[model samples]
Target: MPEYQRIHVSYNGRLGVPVGLFVAVDHLRRAGRLSPDDEALWLTVDDWFIANLPEPPQYSDGNTAGVVTWFKPPLPAAMQRRVEVATGLLSKYGVPWSISESDDPGEIVYEDDFQVAVVPPVRGEPSPMPAGVTLGPTTGGSKQSLGTDASAAARRHLAYYATELADRANRPASPDRQRQLAAFIAQCEALELATILEVGCGGGRDGVALQEAGFDYRGVDLTPEAIDICSEHGLAVTVASAADLPFEDDSFDALWTMSTLMHLDGDGFSRAVAEVGRVVRPGGLVAVGLWGSEPPRRRVDEHGRLFVRRSDSQVRQALSRIGSVETFETGQWYDDGEHYQYFTLRAT
Candidate 1:
């Protein structure tokens, strides 16, 4: 019963609010129920908590159909203050609240250094993502292993780019992104590659580079806004998803998908990779860059988007099913032990 024993934190224990209070407030704002001033008021602590805590996969895209997250105790002073600020908002908003030492909430669907998301017993059904979710040195578990197709998960990702990342789309590639483009271009030239198709080519950043490098280039993205931005620069881009590209078989000599496939997993991932095989001729090149490295999980990021960080081994296993991996590289490990994974494969 030691694991179930309660440990009091800086406040008490009410990290669960059908979802986190933070997520609920976000929904409220979206629904036009919460005022901007009031919402901004609560965002002070909401920002801190999200920046400090681990987000449960169930709440990815702010969906909390099942699971409730509880704060893991022995709180840091700074984090404790933030939680208190959050609790204060709960009071101000007139959201009924409570504090309990009841450590046994229910089934532990997710856990980490910062919190645990559980299926409280009174809830009749299993969590939407009851398969389990965790990150950072913990055992990996998620809906991905069950082979559930989350093709729809990319909707939030597209919206994120259309709004929060619109400016980024319009800007030139970041220095690191520039490096990725350079590497991919090198691979293309080495392969005598031509007729490139860039998947998820937001604002055509990489498309422009590929064309300038003297390769015939075309691109596709699901976000209309991003397509518009790319089109403004006179880049040839069509709205499309990686899982379902509107192109002919063996349509290109090479393909590039950078920081895009990480948003998809399960069947969505499989289909996209399959599309890669379908579009590129045998012996053609495919380059992938993802800001992720872990056993695949549907964990939410600080931005509240579904970023399925997949393990290098799993990614290779999948990619190898369609091609032979010829190059492999990774960026410096992040604070949470994840990293940027990049690789090039020759289609079979």
Candidate 2:
């Protein structure tokens, strides 16, 4: 396994820091100087910094503080050489950068008008910060909320989807999803279940099918526009979060969510699943669908929203924590060669 290295990329002050940083990182990846994992780390760190970029200290005129840090993964010797050769590339685009090395994790080894500080990771230690870089204070001593960021991203995604709702509604449901829905309905029928809650029911595509199949369905989503669209079709819908469903305990006999929980990170996913368990009666059915990959990872979409792709075992393990996973499967659900995992769970 290749060791990871932290590369803190900072600028004095700039308007398009995130976009510029992304361009540089993508250039390195395209030139084969950075691996896919390296690119992912770079983007993740960039997103973090962009999301948390501090306000200028005390009446500063600058629009941004203009400092960002990233943790770069270990590069092979060849890649390192390529990177060295490409050192002056960003400067061509008017983004000057200085490179510095550090053995201690989180120590600022160097600083100049342009600095790229490198720090090694210390196992089991809280993440380190370079010298003189302080994250803003937390409110009420509570940890900084990723939830806020997630909600903002969710809003942006939903807003984008809102503009395409008609096109999405006309698209046929994936055959795998159709089969999974059929199987879940069969199980619900066997248990004489009636009420169903569909979380993240964007345009009510599947929700309409569930209602047509004689289930009492209620759909919830974070996007009001989506809810409005669904409601126009005579579907019961509301705006809500999967992590904090407004329904009471044992309020539903079954829960269905797809391509939704993946928007959440591991902790958020777990909390949402726990909430699912809470609102669902014991032995109620749950069907979860998400894109899957080995070792579960996060990636930013074109809209800058973070999505986690879970492995089959990872999905099963997560569901097992809340209930028994009665069925687990995966298939190519899109023409784009992307595979999706579906799990049928029985709430404990």
Say which candidate scores most in lDDT.
1
Residue 129 error for model 2, in Å?
A: 35
Alpha-carbon shift of residue 201 in model 1 (angstroms): 0.5
Worst 10 residues of 1 by lDDT: 135-144
On residues 1-348, what C-alpha lDDT tens digit does candidate 2 reach at each position? 223233323532123332234434443443434322233333333343344433223214331333334334454332332343234334333445554444443544433322333232332222343355433322211122422332345545654665777777778987778888888888889999999999989888999988988999998875545765787778987555687677889999999999998887767789898898998899999999989776556787887567888778877888898889887778874554356888898999
In model 1, which residue pairs have backbone atoms overlapping below 3 Å? 294-311
lDDT tens digits, residue span 1-348, model 1: 223322222221233233445544443343334333234334333444555677778877444456666666766645554454455445545555554545677889888876777776663322242134222121122221222123223333444566744577557666776887888888789878889999988877677778889998899875555666777666777656688777889999999998888876578789999998999999999998887755445687654355778888988898998899998888867767688888889999
Worst 10 residues of 2 by lDDT: 138-147
How close to the true structure is residue 248 of candidate 1, measured as C-alpha lDDT? Answer: 89
Give Cα distance to truth, residue 96, candidate 1, Å. 53
**After superposition, which runs of candidate 2 have C-alpha atoms over 4 Å from their true positions?**
1-152, 333-338
lDDT of 2: 0.62
Off by over 4 Å in 1: 1-155, 170-174, 302-304
